[model samples]
Target: MQKYWILSLALCSAPLVSAQSLMVTSFDSIAYVNSHNGIQASAHISVKNTSASVKDYRLLRSRIGTTGLVDSNYFCWDLCYPIWVNQSQGTVTIAPGATANDFSGYAYVRDTSANGQDSIWYTFVNTSDANDSLQVMVVYAFNRYVSNSESSLPLLSVYPQPALAGQRIYGIPTDALKLEWMDLAGRVHQVITQNDGSITAPSAQGIWILRAYFQNGIRTTRVLLR
Candidate 1:
């Protein structure tokens, strides 16, 4: 039987409105969450800046999920903090009473497999000064069904979250398998032979599902490109 864990994509709004150099104003439209070994989840993100001064900042997005009855938390964001790993970075200047949108990359969650609740968190950093301040926006997505494909025997892997045209994905164990690229409309667009365990994603917009089949079985995963 394929193990399906239910996760809730709950949206809780909190404002880090303070006298800091950086702040996380809001997060919206987070979905298609994925996890592996009951540990991590990754997805797309949108960020807005709300702070005083011409804030030169970066946005880091990450997820911390449940592990068992006891959950494990892994983070992929902008700063190399104790709780999260830095994934991507960009500089934006937030004018007083102005906001900036960051749609740069993927938010990865690590070690999220506990059959409990999970939370997605974001951090804003002021890159202009090392001594500058930071803020966090943590939202919990509850009652989600984690897929069997995410933690299958073959251990498939994908890369460059917020993937581009040129990035590579690997971890399939053999050849003689087929790769299919499908859209949400139930249409298959690209089919390529799986060779040397990995393949490059096409240069396209929106979300794509990649499926692979081997002598043993089949597995599927998701990627986002913009």
Candidate 2:
């Protein structure tokens, strides 16, 4: 069976009298099924300037473990920067107390092994001085198992089709492994893994996707909130 591995890393710059400090505020993990074509994951990285002065920084370098791989092409926020094989990207300046979001891109794993571990490291440096920098690293591991012969997944049920505010929706299903709720933007809203098969609707009025992972595969259903 196919499985996904996810890891998140948060880094804050060192405190120096003359140097500007930046902290990673929205770093999250992503996962996808491994296939012969390739294993891919989409991630969003963001940082905020916590210092008193404006700071100019550049993505100095990025390194991926031998087991995992990332392509040179990536989509950035202000611009679409192309990453070379050496893993170098463009630069940006952040105002004091301001945040830079939109470091979104795709990561890939070429190896289709049964089990393995890999890591990705991203280093950012001050444009003025190379000595001032910060590094963030993410480690991930995954294992694949034999797929079950059954072709159909277990039936899943959710109560109160149009869930109301402050209402907890009960999800009923057999042999459930995990459940995750995410908004349309792909941001994870909530996760439940005890196999109790219950989730609470978010206060926002919009459409959300509920994904239920089982031993064999995954099932997704759309949920609406009022």
Candidate 3:
């Protein structure tokens, strides 16, 4: 999806090399994203064969760091693999100078208690030669914060009606599940969780619409920042 392109390539970059065969395109060079937990977030990308000869390509996954808080992450090329599997189970044939956009990545976070963030590298390799490969890196983020713009319940209270930017506001709910600061149009600007006892105002000056999530329902309040 286009969301994937928006979050791409600062995490993964490589200098030019000779005899390139595989090239990945149509997605951001580096990407970062924040999505809801317990649901699958997917990104689709295309690969082209820059070589003059036909190339059989297979997908592979390489992790740069630990997979913390993420329940499972997988990729699909010719076939979708289970979470325990890292590479494609099958291969796809690409003609010389042809491109294919059949690669999709999936990630799932099973709970909201812990925030999940994973950086993964996906590569397309020539089946005949391991040296011929193209790789891209993407960062997936899912935090304990959840957003509900339509809740009518009074979830949390803002201590100061007129607070300064970056000022911490108290009176958070005891049973609060998550917190988000949004604009009047309901666009989330910042996310605050239990680790952050009270949410702080952003540097932007305006009427900050603070929303809180709870077991029963969501609540909303407003705080003016100078």
Candidate 2 lDDT over residue span 99-218, tens digit each = 876354444444556355455565667777777666666544433542312337665558788788557887557577777776654445677787655677787887775667776555
Write the residue-wise lDDT of candidate 3 on 1-226 in tens digits.
1111123343345332233886765664543333542234456676788889998988877654476644466665786565567777689999999988767665554554645466667777788988877777766656545442332444355677688988877777667778777664334567777735566788988887665666654455667899
Worst 10 residues of 3 by lDDT: 1-10
Better of 1 and 2 by TM-score: 2
Off by over 4 Å in 2: 1-20, 29-39, 68-83, 87-89, 111-114, 145-226
Please report the candidate that would top TM-score against the real structure.
3
Model 3 regions more than 4 Å off: 1-19, 29-38, 144-226
lDDT of 1 by residue, 154-211 (tens): 6456656667764675554565377767553324567788477777776777877665
- State every prediction's TM-score relative to the real structure: 0.37, 0.47, 0.53
Candidate 2, residue 14: the lDDT equals 22
Stretches of candidate 1 off by over 4 Å are 1-25, 28-53, 60-89, 103-114, 130-132, 137-226
The best candidate by lDDT is 3
Predictions in order: lDDT: 0.47, 0.56, 0.62
At residue 123, candidate 2 shows an lDDT of 61
TM-score: model 2 vs. ground truth: 0.47
